[model samples]
Target: MKWTPQDIETYLNAKEYVDTAVVPLLAVSVGGEMKQSAAGAEFITLLSGHLERQFTGRLLLLPPFTYLKSNYGENTIRDLREWEANLAKEECKHIFYLTSELDWRTQEGGLIGTVIWLPSIPLEHMNDSQKMAVVDSQVKQLLELFTQKWHENQ
Candidate 1:
């Protein structure tokens, strides 16, 4: 399910079965590196969409949790924790934060939910078929990780 009115309606009807939330962590920059930041967000968004499709009934795809690249620090982690708390209160058993920013990897230990950091794959030059092929391959690997996490918690 996605974070849309229609999807939320379906999700409410099957809330218990959809115990997971997938959030894409996006870092925005308005400097010279802005293009790189946008590319990372694009790649992550595509990957998250593909991932959600693979587990539509089991996961809720939330909007990107965006933060300024220059403001990524203790405050950012604290805000992300608040998101986790709210989701947990709503009975979400699993929360996954997917990102292409390497900074997230260093802060994973301080976070309660899983933080998956993948190096950004430049997709601007890829054709539709090529893009699908790359996203599919990444999602396949992610599927294993998700299932493993589910089993561990069970």
Candidate 2:
């Protein structure tokens, strides 16, 4: 199913906060013929804009790294772990993963696709409400963390 801005907002508003910090991660996939690089750039731009408008603090966007062909899942997990480590060094408090599926067009006009997101994170255990809550908290905590870190660094 397609995600909409309203969906994100609704989910965020409906979340219950625990003592844990949640980070927002987005995985986006686009059609192979659709210029994945450009799509990634656009997606980040849109996401950042949304954050700025809806949240009260600054948010940091990470650079996207391309996944290799072999053991993509394992690679994703490793990437996330490294990211977490780096953030930890910087005293970052939250981390979230977002994954997306994209369809690619081939010469035959058939669609090819890929799934991109951090690996090793389990989604099967989360109910719809729980997932929504996670998403909401992820966004919220990211902004919070960013602001907290920014001030500390200043």
Candidate 3:
């Protein structure tokens, strides 16, 4: 579910079943003029929309956490962990941070949850079929990750 009033109401009423929180980690360029970087951001948004639709009420999709790529550092990861703690209080046991940027390499001990980083696909120039194919593959991989987490928890 997304951050809408209707969805939030539904989520609150069904809080026990909504155990997962998916947060998209987006990196916005300084000026938002570079085409490739902008495309990555759009791809994250598109993929995130697909994720929300697939998981529906089981997943709470937060807005993209935007930051400058050049400024990515320990503090960013720290803030993400803090956000994870806040979400945990809301009863979300699994927090997934989805990103396309490869520069955010950090050790697992520092993070409070899982990070799913898929290569960015430039959908702006692709035909409709090509775009659909990429999204299909990405969703399949995400499902596998979610399944793995479910078993680990079990």
Candidate 4:
């Protein structure tokens, strides 16, 4: 479904509903230390905290699923698809995928993140800041959207 700003407004207004936002970040290292890197941990912690604040009593943060191998196999895709489907069934209103490309040989590894707002917020209207927020703290943005929608509905 196309997500319009009004839809975001509507979802935010609802009294009680399950809403979820996903952020997928990719990292690579020569020694598989990226998972334990300070930067990685800090980024995840920041995003988690932000979401928690936004959702307050209604947020559920899923554990981070990291991929160390780069085969990009069919099974990998299937697993991701299944994850998305499960979130959908849980009545998730937002889903964000944050990705980063790593080139160990070139030492050019960095973050490239994207936020996917599902079934509710329209993709077209999202600004750069909003998209970045998805990587940083998408839950807060979702909560903002929810709050806006709630007020409008009333």
Candidate 5:
């Protein structure tokens, strides 16, 4: 389910079946490279929306967690873990953090959830059809991950 008032109501009632929450971790550059960060955010938004649609009945797609790349570090780890922990209170068994930021993968932090990092695609330069093609391939990977998680639970 996408994050919405109506969806939240359904989720509250059917939390038993909805066992996963998907969050997009986004970082914006505050120094001098705004264009690259904008492209990254667009890629993440498209990919995340597609993921939510594919798993609509099972997962909740939360808003993007935006932070300045210039200010990322130990505190970033804290914020991510804390966010995951708080989401656990919603009774979600799995939390998936999706992103195209390659830098986040190298950061050392406790894992409260699984992080799926895809290479950043330049969506702004691509035509809609081309963008959809990229999204399609990525969706397959995401579905496989979700399937693996579900089977493990059983």
Candidate 6:
């Protein structure tokens, strides 16, 4: 389910069947790399929305977890772990963090959730059809990975 009031209500009613939580990890920056950060955010947000639609009732797609690009390290891990802990208490068996920031890969060991890193694709230049095609392709690839993870855990 997407993070909307109506979806939350639906989730609350059928929370038992939704065992997974998907979070988009976004990096914000106002410095020289501002454009890149924004691009990543846009890509991940669109991709995540598409992903959530694919499995609306099976997982909850939380809002993007934003952190400054300049501030990443132990603090980031700590904050994300806090989120994981809370989700676990809510009965989320699988927590997936999706991002376009490659730096997060290094900190995966400290996280209980799975971290998926995909390079950012500039969507600003693409037309609606093009953007949909690109996002669709990425979701297709991710569908296999998500299913594999679910099966392994089961």
Considering every candidate listed, which one attains the maximal lDDT? 1
TM-scores, all models, native as reference: 0.98, 0.36, 0.91, 0.45, 0.92, 0.98
Which pairs in model 4 have colliding backbones?
3-122, 9-149, 12-146, 12-150, 13-149, 13-150, 22-96, 24-98, 96-116
Model 4 scores worst on lDDT over the 10 consecutive residues at 104-113
Question: What is the per-residue lDDT of model 3 for residues 1-154, given as tens digits with 9 covering 90 to 100?
Answer: 9989999999999999988998888887756546767888878888888888999978999988887777778787778778888998877888888888876545355676788887888798788788877887899889988989978986
Order the numbered candidates by lDDT, best leading. 1, 6, 5, 3, 4, 2
Candidate 2 clashes: the total is 9
lDDT of each: 0.95, 0.40, 0.83, 0.46, 0.85, 0.94
C-alpha lDDT of candidate 1 relative to the true structure: 0.95
What lDDT tens digits, residue by residue, belong to model 5 across residues 10-96? 888888988888889898985477888888888889999999989888899999988888888888888888888888887778888
Better structure of 3 and 6 per TM-score: 6
For all candidates, the clash counts are 0, 9, 0, 9, 0, 0
**Which scores greater on lDDT, model 3 or model 5?**
5
Candidate 6 per-residue lDDT over residues 1-154, each given as its tens digit: 9999999999999999999999999999997999999999999999999999999899999999999988987898889899999999998999999999989999888788899999999999999999999999999999999999999999
Error of 3 at 62 (Å): 0.6
What's model 2's lDDT at 127?
Answer: 76
Return whichever of 1 and 5 wins on TM-score.
1
RMSD of 4: 12.8
Tell me the alpha-carbon RMSD of every candidate. 0.6, 14.6, 1.8, 12.8, 1.6, 0.7
Stretches off by above 4 angstroms in model 1 are: none
Give me the runs in candidate 6 sitting further than 4 Å from their true place.
none
State in Å the error of residue 77, model 5.
Answer: 1.1
